[model samples]
Target: MKTINTNIAYKEEGTGEVLLLIHGFCGSSGYWGKVIPMLSEKYRVIAIDLPGHGESKALDSVKDIEQYALVLKDFLEELGIEKVTMFGHSLGGYITLGFAEKYNQYLRGFSLIHSTGFPDSEEAKKGRIASADKIEKAGIDIFIDGLVPKLFAPENVESHKQSMEEVKKIGYEVQPQGAKNALLAMKNRKDRTEILEKTELPVLLIAGESDQLIPADKTFTASGENIKQVVIEGAGHMSMYEAPEELGNAILTYLNHG
Candidate 1:
């Protein structure tokens, strides 16, 4: 594990083509604990704790998705990594699109895991703001506890109680300021469908069959010869935890076949 100057904490293991794992909202690099070792066996795996979450330092000012993308650019530059295949979950997915839009030259490929290229709807924007406000006023513990369960398919809440608790624990570790910044970034993100439609780079869109947040259709909306869609059965948004073996196999297949 190493920390970049901007306090981006990352864990790197194994060797081969670089595979960067970016966790979603309220998550840290630890979110990928179950799958990283499996993937690392085949490719160098670098999992990062985005600013304000896990061991990373919070940014002093509010930041956008592009800003986060730039942070990743700087982090990779610090590591002397010129290119990588990136897998982004949720918020990480938005940042991946931003990175692809501006730093496409550095990308070998990218995947959206339980994420969307669509910008927040007006109603969704309002909801994000409301939740941010609630987190600010009432604190993150209650907010995270209530929210983590919703991220799972309703049916999974009880079946995956231990995993849900791990998620909540990670959520509780998020810097409040960092959480606020992320919400704003997500709310303000521009739709990046154009990148999906035009890029020559390989793309993988993975959806959890029971995901309540970003459904399979939404994840699979963009079609292209370079794009591949995979639906993980009996899983939800937290498929990396709920179905790591299937998810790992899907990723391995994409990396090898793409």
Candidate 2:
């Protein structure tokens, strides 16, 4: 693994056609831990720690979703990866759509997992601002502990408490500034629904049937003719953790067929 400090910390893995995995806010490349081994069998999975999260340094200025997309563009160019299949989860998914809009030709396809293409609702944006304020006041650990439970369905939290705790630990490790910037980016993101219609490459939208964050109905509504939406039953926002095998299978099937 390598770390490149260009406002963000990026890590690369495996070797083949590059498939970039972007994690959600308060998440790191570790989110891909379960799915990487399966994907690495066929493609080079480049999982990145978006700025302010994971090992990446926090940005001095707040970044918008488009800026994050540009950062990924620069990261890819630096690695000499001309073409890629991008996978974004949650916040990562939002950035992936931005990338598709600006750099679609550079992508073989794009996948959005447990994410949304719609701009944040006023209430959601207000909530994000409130979250940022909480992180600034109570510290990252307290915020993470409070946030993790809401990230998954109630059944998942009940059955996978340990796993959920581990995820919370990872969230706690995240820098406060990074988490704050993520919230700012998310709140300021624009709706990129048109990209779904414009991009010729196949698009895959994966949502957990039980995910309350980016519900299946919203995902289906945003999907175009070129898009395929898959909802994993018994899974929540963190589907890869709740149903890794199923998520892995869906990804592999799409990659193989593409």
Q: Pick the candidate with the highest TM-score.
A: 1
Query: lDDT for every model?
Result: 0.92, 0.86
lDDT of 1 at 153: 79
TM-score of 1: 0.98
TM-scores, all candidates, are: 0.98, 0.96
| Residue-wise C-alpha lDDT for candidate 1, range 1-258, written one tens digit per residue | 688786899888899999999999999999999999889998999999999999998996648999999999998998899999999998999999999999999999999999988999999999999999999999999889779987887788888999999999999999999999999999999999888889899999999999988998878868888999999998889998899999999999999999
RMSD of each: 0.9, 1.4
lDDT tens string, model 2, 69-157?
88899888877789999999999999999998888878999999998789999999999999999998999999998889988887888
